[model samples]
Target: MTTSTAPLPDSFDPDTRRVPPLGGFNATMLGIELRRTLRNRRTIIFTLVFPIALFLAFGGQEEWNTTVGRGNVAAYVMVSMAFYGAALTAASAGAMVAVERAQGWSRQLRLTPLSPTAYILTKALLALTLGALAIGVVNIAGVAQGRPSMDVGTWIASAVLTLICTLVFAALGVFVGYLVPSENAMQILGPGLALFAFLGNVFIPITQGSLMWHIASFTPMFGVAEISRSVLTGDLPWYAVLNAVAWLGIFVAGAAWRMSRDTARV
Candidate 1:
C-alpha cells in the first residue's frame, strides 16, 4: 500500500511568494517611524530645547537692535539659530537609524518587503518633520521674546528656507550613522556639527570677501545659513545656492552607497 501526498498551495512555496508592491512604503510605515522617533525622550528634548536656549542666550543682546537690512541684527541671529536647530534635529532623527541597525532591525527589515528607496524616503520625511518642529519651536521663542524684528513675510520665508535646507544635514546624519558604530555615531556627530556650524558661520558672522568667509562658504552649513538669511539682506548669491545643492548631492549619494553596503552585510 502507498500513501498519497497532496501538492502545497502557491502561497506555501517560498520561491513563489508575493511581496506587496513598492516595498510596502505607505502612510502606516511613516507613522510608525514618526512614533518611534517621538518616543526617544533624549532626542526630543535636545532637538527641541537646545536651539531655543542658544537663541535666548545669544540673540537678546541690546546691540543686536541696530538695523542690518530690512530687519534688525536680532532677527538675523534668530534665523541663524532656527537653521541650526533644524539641522540638528534633522540630523539627529536620521542618525537614530544607527540604534535600529544595532538592534538588528536592518536585517529584520530585509526579511520584510521594505525596499531601500522606501526606507530612505520614509526616513527623510521623518527628518523633515522633526526639523520643522525644531524650527517652529525656535521661531516661536523668537516671537515671544519680542526682540527679533522682521517683516512677517520675510520671517515666514526664512523659516521655510531653513527647514528645507536642513535636508542636507539629514542625509549627512544617515551617512554617518551607517558609517560608524551605533555607540559612537552621535558622539562624533554632535560635536562635529557644532564645529561645522562655527566653520560655516552659523554661530559667527564672517566678514564677506575675507579669507575666513571664503573658507566658510565651502562648509556644509554655509549654504543653508546664507540662503536663509538672503530674504532679510536681499542678497542671494549663486554660490550659496550652489554650495547647498552640491553638499546635498554629495551627502545623499554617500548615504545611498552606505545603505547598499549595510544591506549587503546583512
Candidate 2:
C-alpha cells in the first residue's frame, strides 16, 4: 500500500521559486476582457438602445435634413447620439472597478505579479474598446437610416474625436467605481450624465450666446460635444478643447489617487 502525505516545509525553499511579472499590456488579458464586455447583456442593451432610440425619434424628420453646419441636422444628431452612447459605455465599464473591488478581485490581483498601473491601463483600454463599438453601432444605424451626406473625412474625424474624448468618461467610471458600491455607481452616473448631455448641447442644440450655452461650456460633456460636432463645421473652439483636456486630467488624477490608496492599503 502506498500513502500520500503532505510535503514537509523543508522540501520547499522560497529562494528556489520565482514568479515573473504578470503586469503589462497583455494581449491575452485584453482579449478576455473584450469577450467579457461583449457578453454583458445589460451593458450591450443599454449602450446600444438609448442612443438608437433617441436618433430614431429625433433624427428621422425631414425638417432635420436641412443643414445645421456643413452637415445636415441628421448628421449632427447622429454624431451627438453616437458620442453619447460611447460616453455611457466607457463610463459604465470603468465603474466596474467597484464591483471587482467588492468581489476581492483587486486584492487577488494585488497578490499576483500584476502591477496596479497595468491593471488600470487594462481597464481603461477595455472601456475604450467598448466605447468605440458604441460609436460604430450608432454611426451604422445612421447610415442605415439614410443620414445626410457629409465628407468621408468628416465622418472619420468625428469618430476619432469621439473615441479619444471617451477616455475621460472611462476615468470617471474608475473614479466612481472606487468611491461607491457597484449598485450605486451607475445609478448616480446615469441620470447625472443624462443631465450633462442635455446641458452639453448633445440632445438639443443650445442657442448660441445663451446662458445655457455658457453653462454648458463649463460642464464636462460640453468640450467633447463641441469638438466632436466641429468636424462638420470645420471650426474648433479652443476653450472647449481646453475644457476637455482639463477634465481628462482631473479624472485621470482622481482615478490614480484612488487606485494608489487602495493598493497601498493592500
Candidate 3:
C-alpha cells in the first residue's frame, strides 16, 4: 500500500506465436511423391508385362509382316500397344490419388505446407513419369522382339506423339480419382479405359464411312490414336487434331474443377 506494486513483467503472447507458411511448393515433396508412384510394384509390373504380352501375341506374327503405311503391320501394332500401355500407367498413377483421399491424406496435407497447386503439379509429373516408363518398356520390347522396321525419324516421332497423348489420360485419372473416393478407382477406370481404347480406334481401324467408324471418329482415344499413328502414315487430319485437343481440354477442366471443390470442402 505504501508503494505501488512492481510493474507487471512482460509476457509473450501465446496467440502471437508464428506459424510457418501453411502452403508452398517444395521440390523435396515432389521428389518424394514421384518416388512413391514409381515404387508401386504392381503398377510397374503391369505396365511392363501387359504391353509385352500384347506385342508378342499380336505383333510377333508372320501375318503381321504386311505393310501398314510406311511401317509394317507389326510396327503399327507395336506402336498402338506402346501408346496403350503408357496411357494405362499414367492413368493408374493419377488415380492413386483416390486411395490417398480415401485415407484422409488430402485433409491432413491441407494442415501442412503443401499448396493445392503443388499437390496437383506433383501428381501430373508422377503420371507423366510413369507413362514415360511404360512407353520405354513397350518400345524396347518392340525393337527387340516385335522387330519393328521403322526409320529413326518414325521411332522418334511416334514416341513423342504417344507421350503427348498420355496427358489426356493423366487428367482423366485425376478427375476420376477426385470423383471416386474408394479403392474401386482402378476397377472402374481399367474397364472404362479399355472401352475407350476399343472405341478410340487403338485396337481396330474403323472402316471409313461405316457407323462404327463414325462413332470411333468422335471418341477421345480415336483422335490420339490417329494423330500418334500419323507419324507412320504421314497424314494428320485436322479433325483428329481437333478431337485430341478437345478431349484434353475437357479432362483438364474437369480435373481442376473437381480438385478445387474437394480442397474447398476441407
Q: Write the per-residue lDDT of candidate 1 for residues 1-266, one digit (tens) a residue.
A: 24376757868988897778877789988898888888888678757889999999889786889896779988999999989988988888888778878888888988888888888889889989998998899999999998989899999999998889899999999999888866578887899999999988888878989998898899898887889899988888999899999999999999889887785442
C-alpha local distance difference test of each model: 0.87, 0.84, 0.82
Q: How would you encode candidate 3's per-residue C-alpha lDDT over 1-266 as one tens digit per residue? A: 74576743445655655544535666787789878866778787658888778767878677677887888888888889888888888889888878988888888888876777777777787777778888888789887774687888998889888988998998989889888876878888888988988898787667878999888888878899888899997889998999999999998999899887885442
TM-score of each: 0.92, 0.89, 0.87
Q: Which candidate achieves the best TM-score against the true structure?
A: 1
Worst 10 residues of 3 by lDDT: 7-16
Q: Assess candidate 3 and give its lDDT.
A: 0.82
Which candidate's lDDT is highest? Answer: 1
- Decide which is better by lDDT, 1 or 3: 1
lDDT of 1 at 220: 90
- The local lDDT score (0 to 100) that residue 176 gets in candidate 1 is 91
For candidate 3, the clash count comes to 1
Model 3 TM-score, all chains together = 0.87
Clashing pairs in 3: 200-222
**Runs off by more than 4 Å, candidate 2:** 1-22, 263-266
